[model samples]
Structure formats: structure tokens, C-alpha cells
Target: MSSSVTPATLDYLAQRLDELAAQFPTSPDAVDLVTLTDDIGTLGHHLQHAIERAQERFTAPETVYPPERVALVRLARAAAGIARALDTLAEALTYATTGFQREAVEDLAHSPLRNDPEVLRIMTAEKYVAARARLRHTAAALRTASTPAGSSTPRTTGLQTQPAAGPQPRQPNRH
Candidate 1:
């Protein structure tokens, strides 16, 4: 399948990963889980291809030199490590995603509607469904938000909707 991810994009991602490696990584509430997990999975798949290529190169006739063949093995191992690193990244993102969702829901616990019959009913039911709905609702808002993350005000609850008043008819353009 064709990919929009180019060699340059991977190279840049490598560079960014290298830059982030020096930092102490612990940010629970900072969630980019949606894209990061998918990206990491893609990167791991890319590394799997590289690992296979290295194995093929190692067995090539021109690679008869033992040291050169060993180098190919090392290359494959390093690519395998990249997949492991991607796994670590995926784990971190999962933690952040969970943390963010939990925090958002916990905040909802303090809302005035907490004692409302409908709200209490949802709380009493299977919470995973509610948790997922909260995450999806927040994700949709965040994607379309014009303002900064935390600063964005709640527009609607559970689902978004246009005002009951419909849109005005569009005027034809005039020269």
C-alpha cells in the first residue's frame, strides 16, 4: 500500500526521537495517544521491513566476509530495538491517554449535575462505555477547537449540536 510517510519524514522522526531521548519523560496528563500510537505502530512496521532487509543483505554473496555479515546482524538487532522503543512509546502514550481521561471524568464528578438522575444512572452503569464516550467527545472537541487545549470552553455535553435556529440562506456573489 502507498504511504504518505516519506523517507524524509522518517528521518525527521528519528531526529526528533533522538532529541527527546535526553529528557526525563514523565507527563501523565499530556495525551497525544490517537496519533502517537498509530505512528509508533507504523514505525515499528517500518523497522520490521528493515530487519528483513538486513537479514537478506547478510546472506548476499558479496557479504561473505564474516565481520560484514555480523554488522548486518547488528543492524537487524538495532532495528528490532527500534520496534521495542516504539512499544515503550506506545505504552507511555497509553498511560497518558488513560490519565487524561481519568482526570477529565474525575472533574466531571465535581459538576453540579453529578446528583442528577440521568448522570447518576450513567455512573451506576458500566463505566467503560461512559469513559469511552467522554474520551471520544473530548477528542472531537479538541480536534476542532479554535482556542488552546485547557482554555477551550465546553460547547455542549455528550453530543454537539447546532443552535435550534437554522443557518441563514447564502446570498449569490455579485461582481
Candidate 2:
């Protein structure tokens, strides 16, 4: 894509992830499951927007169909992926938990009546953290695999190159 992810967008995503993480153990008890459900939905919405922006800004012009139309199609596919992930997670949580708490999350995740920006913001953060953690873990595993057994990463030395000598001339001084 021609347009890279902007700093502002990264910051926005980070802020949202932080908010979502903060609500974890406490928020679950406070409002039941609405927070989690809303967050997941928000994540889906944000991904949809992101995919649209990416295709519009990054894709080459010679791609057959119109830019906006192509972006929309890609956006829909991305949104569908997010929705499926949310549905699976929601179903698992519902099946695994009991009482008002489970009900709350289930309702929020599946709710057709409400859509809150705050909740979505938090959910977006949740997804970011989860994805980042996965990336870090994968990186660590790869590093470990690539490293030689019992060998530490090699250190760098600060040395400059010297020019090779070809010939030297001698000078005589007269008294």
C-alpha cells in the first residue's frame, strides 16, 4: 500500500487497547459482559474501516475495478473475519461460564439494540494486545530456534578500515 499506517492511527489504537486492558477483571464484575461484547464489536468495526482505508490508499490504480468499490469488497471480507472471530469467542465464553456475567457478555456480543463507541474502543484495544502478544511470542520462538546452542548473540566492534600502503618516498635535507 502507498499509504503507510499513520502515527495518529497507531496512537489511537494503542489508547483504545490500554482502555480495554484496564477494564479486564473489574469491569467484568461491574457491568457483567457488556464491556467485552461491545469491545469485540468495536474491533470489528475498526478493522472494517482500516481495511477500507488501506485498499483505497495503498492499492495500485490498474486493478480492474474502481478503487472505492474494490475497497468496499475487501472491507466487507475483513469485517466478516472479525465478526466470525467475535462470534466464536462469544460462544465459547457463554458455553464456558454461568449466571449473570455470562448472560451480560452474551447479550453485549450478540446485542442488536445497542452500539457504544466507548465499548468498541475498548474492544479494539483488546484485539491489539492479543495480536501483539502473539507476535512477540512468535518472534521469541523464532529467535530461539535460529540461535546456535548455548551461544549468546555476537557483539559488534567499533573499528574503522585503514588504507593499504603501496610505496613511500624519502626526502633529503641540505645543510
Q: Best by lDDT, which number? A: 2
List residue ranges in candidate 2 displaced over 4 A.
1-4, 26-31, 59-88, 96-175
* List of clashing residue pairs for candidate 2: 1-58, 2-58, 17-125, 33-105, 39-123
The parts of candidate 1 lying over 4 Å away from their true place are 1-26, 59-62, 93-175
lDDT of 1 at 135: 29
In model 1, the Cα lDDT at residue 102 comes to 44
Which TM-score value belongs to model 2?
A: 0.35
lDDT of 1 by residue, 1-175 (tens): 1112122223333443343232212232222334344445454554655555454444544523444344344444445545556555554444344442343256654566634444332332223223223323332332332322333212211221121222232222211
Give lDDT for model 2: 0.39
- Candidate 1 lDDT score relative to the true structure: 0.37
| Clash totals for all candidate models | 0, 5
Alpha carbon lDDT of residue 90, candidate 1? Answer: 51
Over 11-128, each residue of candidate 2 has an lDDT whose tens digit, in order, gives 3433443443343332212333444455455545555555555555445544323433333344344445445545544552443233223343556555542344345334434443
Report per-prediction Cα RMSD to one decimal.
Answer: 20.7, 23.0
